[model samples]
Target: MPEKSYPMTAEGKEKLEAELKNLKVVKRPEVIERIKVARSYGDLSENSEYDAAKDEQSHLEDRINVVEEMLKYAQVVDATSIDPDEVAVGKTVTYTEVGETDSETYTIVGSDESDPLNGKISNDSPIAQAILGKKKGQKVTIATPGGKFDAIIDKVED
Candidate 1:
């Protein structure tokens, strides 16, 4: 089996690298110091502080591993190299629902950078998946848990 590639924009890759750096250079050292302090409290079996610190260490290590793996398989999608007429990862698309009066925009990104509130959506999301590879002005049907709606692609920007 091949490792799954994560498609992300250059900005997304930079953000991930920054987070990883913070985890390794800052969070790791801070957690180590916490563990050391907890150990000095003595009795490991009954020390809640020690237990909590150890648990936190476990979770932190898990998160570090996940981030490392994601970075290792990242495939950077350069927006400038893509066709402005096509919708793809790293492109911001504007569309209007069939019955909606207003148009909305969203930037399709990797799962790691998905922030719906900020208009960044994961490529794996239902709406993104439905519109990927579509051309501007094309009509696409998006199926979500709520219902299905038609989206008319208005614009695609690199």
Candidate 2:
């Protein structure tokens, strides 16, 4: 099978690595121990604790596998290389809505690193696609859940 590629920032990769380590080193062992104890307690079919522990072990292993795959195909993105004058992944951009006059700020990141609540948006997102390669003072139309609206790029920063 082809290994999937992951486009992620260094910080994001580190976070994922930490989670993987936790799952493998801590959670996996803890769940196995729980299952062993539960097995000693009672009959297999009627033991809810054993069932729950087994489920937890499955989930933990699944997470470990996912993280390993992501690590294998990880692509690190550096925030410093992006041009301050252009919209690109790893760039922090500020914009103002055309008619609403409200200003918004967001950091363009890879799909794996996007966290909307923290103002980090995926480069593949509609808004990012509309703004990519655009410069300050350039207007762009974005189709959002709220509705289609226009925005003007105010500034681009690291």
Distance from true location, Cα of 34 in model 2, Å: 0.9
Cα lDDT tens digits for candidate 2, 51-88: 99999988888878888988989888775776668887
Tell me, by TM-score, which candidate is best.
1
Which pairs of residues collide in candidate 1?
none
For model 1, state the Cα shift of residue 44 in Å.
0.5
The runs of at least 3 residues in candidate 1 whose Cα sits more than 4 Å from the true structure, single-residue gaps closed, are none
lDDT of 1 by residue, 1-158 (tens): 98789999889999989989998899889889999999999989899988888888898899899889999999998877877899999999999999898999999999999999999999999999999999999999999889999989999998
Each model's TM-score? 0.97, 0.87
